[model samples]
Target: MVPKQTAEIFQILSKGNFISSNGSQARLHDCISHDDNFRILKEYFAHIGYHLESGHNYYYFSQQDETNTNMEKKLEQFAHFIDVMDFFSCLDVKPVTGTRYRVTQIAEECFANERLRQKIFALSRKDKLIDKVIEVAGSLANGGFFEQEDEDTYKVMDAIHYLETIISLITIDDDGEQKNS
Candidate 1:
């Protein structure tokens, strides 16, 4: 039988969010990684209808099939993420895992570049440059790709590789075409 903590772990992973080793919840991550605990939890969760999955220093849940509405929502969310990623990529700062960035730094960069400011405006509903930076960074943090280290600083999480991997899988075909599905 799985321990109560194991059940609690399952509940967290069941959401699309991730559990990271170096994240704020390090204790929970360590608890999940303890000797033979992952194996036991995997088996127990399978019977209860969840497939436990792990990635580099993180764990999340994935299922075989999703409903049409669920798929649509995910695809739309991914589209938004792709735009956010493109905006960040345009910045000199790359969003590689473990990179630390400050809201003020990004806002300063945006203020220096009209194109960057435009991109930030598109992604953010906030009016001020700093607020826009905060909004975008906050969104990434809420998505589990970044961890807030302090009031205005964030460190990218290992789970960011998940988004990068999905983005890399997106391909444009020959003859200026894009693949569907």
Candidate 2:
């Protein structure tokens, strides 16, 4: 029989969100990771055209065929993620799984560091430093790479590996060209 949480899994993954092992929905993650569940869910989702794909301690859905519009939108979204990851990579506290970050603290860091301030300014049009930080953090949170614990604190989720993996796969050519495989 299919897992009891099949509907719950479908609800989240179908919306393009991940069930990350370190996020609030970790129970759902555990459900998917259990023996036979992945195979079962993969078959179930496949019948409906979604391919249930697993990443490092996380699960999401992918479509076998995507329209050009969807592909373009995803490329745009990934480009935004590149900038967001760049900002996070420069932080004193890296964006590893389970790492918690506070907006005010990050804003203070940006206030003290001209480089960080410039990076965040490029990412957000918000007038306030704190708002700019919030925009970046909120983007990640909305994308399932981070989960907001409270009003000000957000914790990185295991799904962040998806971003890291994609970013790491990118390479700069000898002619200063960027390429992704």
Give every collision pair in model 1: none
Give the total clashing residue pairs for model 2. Answer: 0
Assess candidate 1 and give its lDDT: 0.83
**Per-residue C-alpha lDDT of model 2 across residues 42-151, encoded as one tens digit per residue:** 99889999999999999998888769999899999999999999899899999999999999999999999999999999999999999999989999999899999999
Steric collisions counted per model: 0, 0
- Model 1, which residues run further than 4 Å from truth? 1-4, 176-181
Residue pairs whose backbone atoms clash in candidate 2: none
Each model's lDDT: 0.83, 0.92
TM-score per candidate, chains pooled: 0.88, 0.94
lDDT of each residue in 1-181, candidate 1, tens digit only? 5666875676667766788877776677777778877888778788877777777788777778669999899999999898888888888979887789899999999999999989999998887999988888888888888899999899888788888889888875677566543
Model 2 spans > 4 angstroms off: 176-181
